[model samples]
Target: SHYFPEMRALLNECQFNNCLHINEPGCAIKKALEEGRIHAERYISYWNILDSFDEKY
Candidate 1:
């Protein structure tokens, strides 16, 4: 249940409750990534880790 504080804050501001932060409209996380607020490498690493977890379980 732990999440990055910056991501948590952006999620709170997202327009949708079920946003995946990928191709969703009004995604605060995407906006941050586009605006250079969040580093792309960090985000990609997070996604890779999440994908690993999904594959394991």
Candidate 2:
């Protein structure tokens, strides 16, 4: 949430308790991104970080 304050509240709004906000179903953060409520650039950066983790591990 620190990375994206806009995602803080929506985090809990996700369908699952463990929603990673990556590509999970019923992800509130994704929904907001799709609806243009959240900035696309920030979402892109978030994806980049997650993708980097894949390379590290």
Candidate 3:
């Protein structure tokens, strides 16, 4: 959770406040990923770590 401040910052640049960064129109994070601004492995690693926390419960 503490690892993604840049992603969080990118959220602010999203056109929609409710953007989920997945299949949504005008999503900054998605756009960054598409533009190669944000590395795919880093994003996937963050999600993998976050998903592990969900499984702990």
Candidate 4:
């Protein structure tokens, strides 16, 4: 599912440029998670794909 326009806009305003909407510092996505705007599992799962690829290698 796509994020809302307002949500994307909010994410774009993150303090850092490398914000991956993950656990990185100053991440808008993490803030959104704290405020109940995003789900915990979904957030972790997004990054877990990298782990999945690592396992294959």
Q: What is the C-alpha lDDT of each candidate?
A: 0.78, 0.87, 0.76, 0.65
User: Which parts of model 4 are misplaced by more than 4 Å?
Assistant: 1-10, 53-57
Residue-by-residue lDDT tens digits, candidate 4, 1-57:
124443465666677876666557777767877988766676666568756866999
Among all windows of 10 consecutive residues in model 3, the one with the lowest summed lDDT is 1-10
Which candidate number would show the highest lDDT if scored against the true structure?
A: 2
What ranges in model 3 sit over 4 Å off? 1-3, 46-57
Give me the runs in candidate 1 sitting further than 4 Å from their true place.
54-57
Model 3 C-alpha lDDT per residue in residues 1-57, reported as the tens digit of each score: 235876877877888888756567888887888899888987787678867877997
Model 1 over residues 5-55: C-alpha lDDT tens digits? 667777878899888777789988889989999888867866777778889
TM-score per model over all chains = 0.76, 0.85, 0.65, 0.56
For model 2, residues 1-57, the per-residue Cα lDDT tens digits are 446889886888999988878888999999999999999998898888888888999
Shift in Å, residue 40, candidate 1: 0.8
Please state every model's RMSD to the true fold in angstroms. Answer: 2.0, 1.3, 2.7, 3.8
Evaluated at residue 10, the lDDT of candidate 2 is: 85
TM-score of 2: 0.85
Which 10-residue span in candidate 4 carries the lowest summed lDDT? 1-10
Q: What RMSD value applies to candidate 3? A: 2.7
* Model 4 alpha-carbon miss at residue 24, Å: 3.2
